[model samples]
Target: MAKCFPEPYDAVSESKAELLLYKALAEQLGPDYVILHSVAWISRPGGSGPREGETDILIAHPVRGLLALEVKGGRVSLDYRTRTWVSIDANGVAHDIKNPFDQARRGKFALLEKLKESPAWKKLGIGRFNIGYAVFVPNVGDGDRLRGPDAPAEMIGDRRDLSDLGAWVGQVLDYWSGQEGAGQQIGTRGVDALVALFARSVSTRPLLSARIADEEDVRFSLTIRQAAILDILRRQRRVVIAGGAGTGKTLIAREKAVRLASEGMRTLLLCYNRGLADHLREQCTTIGGLDVATFHQVCHRWIERVKAKNGRDLLSEARANLPRGDEFDHHMPMALANAVDTLGPIYDAIVVDEAQDFGDEFWLPVEMLLTRPDEAMLYVFLDENQDIYRRSAEIPVQGEPMVLDRNCRNTDAIHAAAYSHYRGAVVEPPQISGVEVNRLLASGIEKQAALIGTLVTKLVVEEGVAPHEIAILLCDPADRPARERALQTLPLPATVKLGRVEDFSRGGLTVDTVARFKGLERAVVILWAFDRCDVGKDRETLYVGMSRAKSLLYVVGSREACDHILAAQT
Candidate 1:
């Protein structure tokens, strides 16, 4: 009597166990009855291939046509709370074992099919032997301790008790052997007959249906990128969003925030930097939607509002309750640590923008705030390619990424030029039409500025394009002297070195850093200043800078830099 009977057997274990059981049964029941295990019995055509089905063991006697057995080894107790059997361990941890009667009933149908294939079965007449169930419990702690409702099977406390088993087996054989002369009984057809018999035998009723009602659809509209983000949010209980500059990752985040809020689900929009948080907050406000704040700000509000209402000093409490492996460094921000400690779960969804820049440590507190399997979802947006601070920044996301490939904003020419110059890493080209890209060589800063200024005048004045539709992008904002000269020489009002929303006035010509202008699009012209010599390493910066334009790209660079762009185009 093994204590670990029916202990989580897989296909191989079940096969091996079946073989051992067959040998044991032959010795106990004598040579009269036939014992079979793991027999492939197929009836349904063009359905799933024959695999493991219910009946694991079958016994047939001259009088009895077939008998099915389900076995297990454990102390079973009735769960008064769950109204089921509670199979507990030595440490009192309970496992809800599925009922053995259910297993026996399923096995009965499978056994009947196997019986029909046997010549001996037809000789005895299939209806002569009465089918029944046997449940073998090998190591019952107390033999008479019955739990829950009785099952369809004749419950045996211990299979090791050969005297009791041998007597019961003999009686069943004799009764069926006497009935062999009885004419074949006409019975109700198919699985329904066996199911009805098994139901009458078991005290606990069988489940009649397993279907559940469908859920109502939630109404929402989103761009492809935004829809992809929402799909990930719905499928993966945990996720990260990474995007390069100008990919509209933040815009996607804002839309997600609005949708979640509309559903009356609390949503949080988090950013690593305060400036980006402020920017998102402004955008969310303009859209008349959810509250967007930096993670630190959220924590500060919780400490001041939530902890105060509870009359607890959150900082002191956190210091006293610090868990192991959570030691803090001196340079870590107190506000961040306090927020991580005192922050209440206010949001159903937590969307983090600039996720790539938010290092590994930034996620530790955020992870604590998430509710497992339900209640909350996490979405992080980032761009590995636009990660200029990699040497100093610790990226939080680990593994190959789920990338958004289709360029929804830029034109094909713009996307093509960007990807070509940037080692062809851009996943898909843009969908827009009527775009042209040009590469020009200049020896110095003044020459580069003159070329950019000429392109701006031609696009705005000659082509009848608006000045606001044109953009002048510099790889490094520190190269402002040339940017200023170009803006001063241009024939229209020009916005120079604009990084934030505040810097964007009623537009004419917009000038900004390549990094800042990554996710934005412009019509007519993009004046990219590739003033540096290490053009190969800076190719991505140039590519992203040039692709911002809808109609035309005018790249101004040194001859050595221009050669790299020409080679990329080829």
Candidate 2:
């Protein structure tokens, strides 16, 4: 009658001992407790790559708080000299395994750290209950050789503890869970909250999947200027649309690709950002004859095709033979354009997003890829105010540039904060009503990271915003690791996943650099500005980060920078 979370069986192992123990506990403890299996946590290494580890079993009781158990089956041997635990199989071969006690302890620390971030843990007042750990060896009974000074009596369990069901529960509650069986307990309200918290923490559904499912409820309408650009795109073969953030540039590009594909035109969608390109691909995959690629990806694919045709990778040869600087993007296209006659256009139409990020040299090869450079359909979307990379390429176009001035994404209050960076830029007029942007001032980078974690938790747990709707964007590339480490320490809810923008879901939060999220929007954005405090030097970059939020925005930075930003906004 006990509630089980994510099922009790393990696909990785064939052991039935853990389930047997579960059944015994259910019969003893009744339906008041919830059992969670295979709960996992990501371990962030200091110098090495992150590793993920899972706990075998977690039992949550209203009276006992929480218990983590490491369950093992079959014959187990302890090499007291090497201090190693091994499982001896039927063939008499020893399989090296982690110590069950150590495994259970690690799970305890991970869960404690995770719980530290959740407000629910504090709200339930279950903090008073002891978080316990134990090791269950159901196959091994209390024998002559097994019980010794090395074997801790309370932590280890054998057949004797398993035989008398009612007595075993009493022993577990007393020795393992640290409860004397009465008085030291949780109320019904506290029990309910703890059960819900434990269930969510161990849920198997990926945060991104839930967010994608929730995106159906989000509503957005194209502005008059946006509709006009689409109308013009229907008639013109080649056109350029320029607009600032929230002006619907990405949306326009996506719609054009889908429409062209619907007409059976082979369309190629291009963007400078790989993450945005990935998102575009997902959005356009349903349409036949529509392909999405980043500028570098397209170049790599073309090089691969050339290698297949002529048995030589021209791009690699060009990189080695050609006299070029560190600007690979600028030099790559120029180097390849010299051999453009060898390659021909592959698509009926090409739609480029984030055009401002491309240099002048990068476009020649891109233009050469068009089957009919002049007659074939081409649509380029750009916003000069968002040219954070400082590329000054005049986007190749056939006619007067179409401009979208209405901001359909951000509210009037959010626009006020973003527009403070550029005094006279012809940006979009804010159309939505939004929460007032806040300037979170911290003394240092470490403090800033801590502050951001707290703010994100508050927004998700207390403010009722979905984890996926929130984004923490770093302004400088150098600050990625520090920001990631800081985010790891926060006790974030289980529903929010930290990931890159291209593959993110609406059900979880995303932590990425500002550049990767150029074309994306979030309901709440916390812009980390600790790297470069000078707003004058990086105005466009600051503006790009500020304009990403649709509803709420918190600009987190050093004290001096935050004060300066607040003053300017006023």
Candidate 3:
């Protein structure tokens, strides 16, 4: 049967008859036609830029190219002279409406224009495709109401002729197959390829796969190393767990805090990054007796609490004396610890994520905040390879760290690319399969921008990737604005929101510097390394950026830059 992207049951409808007709057509056509329901225009009709044009049913046939059908459920009558349509309701009341045939024609051209602008058609070597438009009045007894100069013989049909939509579709396909043009006459291979293209376009299979990937990411599976860490936590009050990127360091820390909180322990979950801390807070809030905050947040709160208790405004004093720069974040906790000593230990258990981001000076205050400095439960998760802040103070670990080696995020292809730049001795293997890492060589910034635009367009339009699922990560923070400009150069589908990570929180493609996207992951990543001077010798930064992708990774840069990265492969 015809494969419907969304089955008729799930689709929203103005009337039940419309849904019934869609289901009937799907049952009639057997696996040859790919039918899409509620296809909207890439751009608005008669607008300078793209706008929404709604189409009821879209059919993609191997030989016929594309067809848009405007289905009218009730008895629809056409006034030839007035060029208007009157749809009769169940109450025998006629309501004047805009001509659906005209609407379908506009939708047809709108979709055709959209396809023409996309790079997918050119890549597939179908520069042009024959587009057909029809108005199907399935409930009308006589086809005469819908027929006139406004409705062509082939473009207008009723239930009598359109009921067996498969046969009608076959006739249209055969007619288009015999036409003379660059778009006509598909070879046997071409037919299959075209049909597959349409299937991918309308299918929700990718979303299902994405959901599975999301499940794999959010739900933790205990690896041998993770199990060992849990075992260590059970016995040891002071523990340090260290591993490379994608080694599930963050997952372990979150789970440890969750378990402690679930046991009714007054647990404190801390991280260096505010974004990561926010994520932890959300995850840990479900359990009781947990307080989640970043290192700076903890310090600030400690200062505030001390001031409130002693009636002394220490925050104002520290703010006036604190020096500003990149060192601000690294030094704030230490400054707070020096100024405040009266605050006693408030938490029974403490868990730190991204512990390497803090210095040794910061941990003394963390220790003081515990109920028992020597016996209180303390778990610190560390990955030195991801120590982008370059803290020099060595964290005091009493014994050997429990190392996690298996990666749960990146695919084999992604691991291969990231491993080429990895500095640590420990290597992580891929957990999932079928992901590919693609590399492109560009001569300059402009060339790289063009390449990014083309590749992303093809991926969204042809391969059917959700815009928000794709991220454009830049090595240098300065390149982010320029990269966003390049994204605007692309004529992507209107559904894509081209906003930065700071402003946009909803779906659409995200363009951000790799540093800002450190704690985030996407289905697909496009890493732009146009100006490598920013991270010329920093392998950790490069490695972190490369490993952010969960499935597909696209690395674009100059040949020299590309070669330099490839040379690091061991």
Candidate with the greatest lDDT versus the true structure = 2
lDDT of 3 by residue, 1-570 (tens): 877856776666776666877888888987766777765422212323224355788877666677788888778877677776788988899989888878888887776655443333434566555667777777876765566665655666677865687777666545444453427533334444433323222111221133222332344356655655664465467778887777777777877786666544578998877656765675566677799998888877877777677876665555556645233554566546754577656677889888877876688778777766666678888877777778765665598877788877788878887777666666668668755677788886778888887887788789877777788888767656666676688766776776655443445677877766665577788888635643446777788888888789888888777666655553
Off by over 4 Å in 1: 1-229, 242-248, 271-282, 286-289, 293-334, 343-345, 368-375, 391-401, 421-426, 489-501, 524-527
lDDT of each: 0.52, 0.70, 0.68
Question: Residue 219 in model 2: shift from native, Å?
Answer: 1.9
Pairs of residues at least 3 apart in sequence or in different chains that clash in candidate 2: 117-491, 211-506, 211-507, 467-508, 468-508
Candidate 2 per-residue C-alpha lDDT over 1-570 given as tens digits, one digit per residue, 9 for 90 to 100: 566764444323356777787666655655777777655543222312223446777776776556788888777877667878887666777799887777887887766664543345455555445667777878777522443463466667777777665455445556754433344466667556545544432111111222365553444666556755664565477788877778778887887776666544577899898877877776666777788988888777777667778787676667676556543664457545644657766676789999989888788888888766766778899888788888999677867788777777788988878877764447766756766888787867678877887887788789878787788888887868867887787777777778767547655578888888887777788888544656787778778888888889998877677667656678
Every model: Cα RMSD to truth:
19.8, 24.1, 24.0
1 versus 3: better TM-score goes to: 3
Task: Give per-residue CA lDDT, model 1, range 147-251, as digits (tens).
Answer: 335541234334444445556655543444454443343232322233222211111110100110121132122345645455444334345665544455666
Q: Which segments of model 2 are wrong by more than 4 Å?
A: 1-211, 216-218, 335-340, 423-425, 502-507
Question: Candidate 2 vs candidate 3: which has greater lDDT?
Answer: 2
